[model samples]
Target: MVCVPIALIVVVVLIDVLAPPHIHLGPLLVAAPAITASFAGPRLTGLVAALAVAAQALIAVLRDRDELFSANHQAQIAALVLVGASLVVFCVVRERHARELSQVRYVSETAQRVVLRPLPHRIGPLRVASLYLAAEAEAQIGGDLYAVARTGHGTRLIVGDVRGKGMTAVGDAALLLGAFRGAAHRQADLVELVTYLDGSVCWDLAEPGETDRSGETFITATVLDIPDDDDRVDMIDCGHPPPILVRGGRARVINAYQAAPPLGLGDLARPRYHVDSFGFEAGDLLLLYTDGITEARDSAGAFYPLAERIDGWTEDDPAAFLHRLRRDLLDHVGGHMGDDAAMIAIGRAPASRP
Candidate 1:
């Protein structure tokens, strides 16, 4: 960038020195300051402007040594100086704005880390990898959330999506994650774990001044329990997308026969959360994701066909499968999604003996 301004100054000088006298190449010197405004700050721009002024004076002297300060050259010198000063001011403003933007991005990333802690690679007998893509790039974390914990009975995990966006949604996601982490160790079963989370979220929004949002706020989550020695995975779906089971080079969605209403609206219909069981054999992989993955759309308004894509990837390693899925999803949506997305891939370790 600095080179651009310097080069412009050099070319303008050459033209002024070598070109025909009637061509009047002095005006072109302003290009130095103008180009510097794009990439350099006030100090650098001012330096370029000074050089331009000096070059103009030199040209004036070269043209008529006795008339260097005469009226004819004075007007041109004043114009060049005015334009350079204006460009210096513009550079100052641009640099200030850039610094402010950088600071804002730093704060946003810090908040994201606080809300969404990193997922571990190994949990109990399963090898795990997770991914999150926020719809709003400025907001590193949105409504999507996932967490895993090793409990006394087994390894418990939850993948959830809050109802809204912005800080409110982030707060709700944090609340649910915190509740799950605390309750997973104490609750003996999946049902109890989910019940604790539901009650906590329900009560959180019902607080004195928070009731205004209570009517609309809710979270859709899927809770899972993988026992240490069992060959099955248990799930409790609360108005969320179903998990997918991959085994023996085939893929299938594990839909729940019964699902309760999403938490925070349990007062509307107090149905019991059913625990759905599925066979998780050796070398099997389980995929849990939020709606952002399935609901992603292309220009033609077609939804992402996740199951069809996964069918061919059933035999791929868990890490490779997720990598392909993420790339394919981005391509399906033309590289921009309108909602926050998250996915967790859990592969049962084959070496473990029951």
Candidate 2:
């Protein structure tokens, strides 16, 4: 539908070029974007149309003083009409888009509430915090995802990255979330949960149909379980970045004690998972994230430093810490994200005095 008007603009331009002695192309030209004004987003379409009309109007006004029958008067009328029509279209389309955007946001927010429920402010004497950036500004869902649930075993957490974006990625993500929520509760160990997720992915792969495109959907994930607040934090690195542990105001990456392949396509070979244990002490911060954070690059292609970036910024608030991280990440990436990002922070408060 939006392409139709763009085509109309091209035709109008061609017609004017071919037969400029007759046929008015200016109004049609102005109306072309005005047609897309209802779809290209109100702000963008309106701005573009305004600039286009104003530029031509000024050109016509300037040239009229020196020319005979310069088509200036008629152009001015058409420009003004288009501008006015664009404004009206902008208002109506803006309202419609606002409503649609609101609905998408609501759905996304609901999905977040259901699938990415925030960890409690305090989880077993530790402060729980997190941040999430969906790849699409208009869509609530993306390929990166994370979830934390206090299971019978302990605080179970899962962070995974799906392939691609848009509707297809969202569908895959939904499958993963359902698997995690079910298996997280049913399975006692994180490794078994990994197996369940692998099976689920393989199942979903078949649904997308066999494509000889030499492409398959796979997810890089990390699963963690905290047995207690002061004990070691158990983590399974299934291809995610090694989480960072901050203690005494120092941040350090916790390398996987053992490495394993990413989830999905595991039937190609037997998958092995190494559970790494990290020292969890009072006043220590544990940050887990998807690849989006580490992969965020500046205009110069300098990748973001996941572990070393926020060493000295000390705020006792977990949410604030993650929020600041998100802002810094966007600033580094020029306010755009090429991939979905998800993160969760678990910090142990200073131990109660003995």
Query: How does each model score on lDDT?
Result: 0.84, 0.72
TM-score: model 2 vs. ground truth: 0.69
Q: Which sections of candidate 2 miss by over 4 Å? A: 1-113, 136-140, 207-215, 350-354
Q: Best candidate per lDDT, number?
A: 1
Score residue 105 of candidate 2 by CA lDDT: 76
Per-residue lDDT over 78-173 for candidate 1, one digit per residue giving the tens place of the 0 to 100 score: 998999899888888888987886776577567767877888788777888888876744444467888888976579989999997777888899
Model 1 spans > 4 angstroms off: 56-86, 134-136, 269-271, 292-305, 314-316, 326-340, 351-354
Tens-place lDDT digits, model 2, residues 67-184: 4336655555566566756566767766888899888878766765565655567766668887777665456466777776667646787888877765566667778878888788
Question: Top TM-score: which candidate number?
Answer: 1
Model 1 lowest lDDT segment of ten: 133-142
